[model samples]
Target: MSRIMVIGSLNMDIVSRVENYPLPGETIKGIKTDVNPGGKGANQAVAIARAGGNVSMVGAIGTDVFGDQLLEALQQENIETNNIIRKEGTSGLAVITVDSKGSNSIILLEGANGLLSMDDLTDILPEAIKDPANIFLLQNEVPWETTKNIIESLSASNASIYLNPAPAQHIPTEIISKLTGIFLNEIEATIITGLSVIDQESASAAAEKLIAYGVTEVIITLGEKGSLYRDFREHVYFTPGRKVNAMDTTAAGDTFIGAYLASKQQGYSIEASLEYATAAAALTVSREGAQKSIPYQEEILQFLT
Candidate 1:
């Protein structure tokens, strides 16, 4: 089986559910609020494990209670966490607000996640990344420079790598060329490519730009509408999102990514994997919380069947 290693952030997600988003200088009462163990990296690790992918977590956490809780949560998922180090200060934090429509906005505090460095990566991967089956699942929650260095370091290796650039930032085209694939939502798509992704055609145009930069594959997720896929070969595909009662969309993107990668690792075809991921994400939105809302592999299978 292919092993996926997630090098991303771990945060305590604080979420508030409001009727709608508050405008600038406006305040609104929340329907409810809760805290959950989440970080793009940690969330994806839980997702991969739950989706039946062989996964390991590599990152840093604080020495606080949240860190202890985060560690315990990963352990419960049966993910390998040997590379998750402990820093001196507070853990990462994500303050989020979800509307009744299941849409959300978030603000993040870097904290220990910012402590991740190339040295940490060197200690974790070493020579294993030379193996193509050792897939690295990364995100933008960590330092961009560190992330870039990891990609550059693997340029000489055959390792498979993918980036989910949430909270998108500028990256060099040379670095983009080294990736096996890039998965992102429409909003993130706009930030990275400087193009609008209001629909499938727009998303494709954006994907084409990345393909021209030499990334092998690009998948742009369209919330509720569906997802669009395009590769360097100009081959394109679309997968419609499943209609359901969406309660919270906090983990939808992460769940989709986790399930899709797990499905691919398990030898599912691209079409099947997209379906699996869409189903997994649809199931996640029907529930509440981040990692807690994500379904297990059997649940996705059952949901599909």
Candidate 2:
């Protein structure tokens, strides 16, 4: 039985609800405010655990109240957290503003998340590299250099390494060549490939470019439209998005990635995994918050059935 090892950031999200976004220099009143446990890495880990997959988390958090709360939150979800480090500063936080339409804009403060060093990630690979069954998941919430170092280090290993390059940054083709694949949203795909991905045709073009750039596999999630997976062999799998009254879409992408990975690890076919992930994401968008919005395995099973 293999498990997923998530090595990345853990952030506390401070969210405010507004009818719509205010223009620059314009002050607006919020409908409500809520604090939620979030972070690309932490969200995916929680999603994996709730989706019934074995998962362990690794990252850095500050010695602040938010850090403690984040740790406790993950523990409550039954996610393994022994590798999370404690730093002497404020924890990472994201200031989010969600509109009544369920769209969200966010500003991130790195804080202790930037303190997650490459050395903190090295020990997990030695044993994992020897096994093809082990999966290492990464995101761009931490320092780019740390993520780059881990990807480079795994170049010679047999372990499955997948990067969810959110908060998109410039990634070299050499790095892509070493990955098992990538799972990212349309915005990330646009940033990474310098392409405008407003629909499937554009997403298809971007996926081709990523494949040309050396990524062996690619999965691009298009909100409302659907998600598509592309491999080097030119095979394609697409999953249409389920329609629902979305309350807050902040966690939908994370939920999809986690559910897809969980399904794959649980021995489902690629098409089946994408379908499960789509259903899980539909569940996520219909709710509010981050981790709290992600559906449990039983819920997803029921939804699919």
lDDT of each: 0.89, 0.89
In model 2, how large is the Cα lDDT of residue 200? 82
In model 1, which runs have C-alpha deviations exceeding 4 angstroms?
16-33, 97-105
TM-score, candidate 1, is 0.92
Deviation in angstroms for 157 in model 1? 1.1
Query: What would the per-residue lDDT of candidate 1 be over residues 235-280, giving only the tens digit for each residue?
Result: 8999988999988787799999999999999999988999999999
Task: Put down candidate 2 lDDT per residue, 127-237, tens digits, no spaces.
Answer: 566767878999999989889888888767646889999888878888888888898788889888899988888888989998888778899999988998898999888
Which 10-residue window in model 1 sums to the lowest lDDT? 123-132
- Candidate 2: the clashing residue pairs are none
Model 2 lDDT-worst window of ten: 121-130
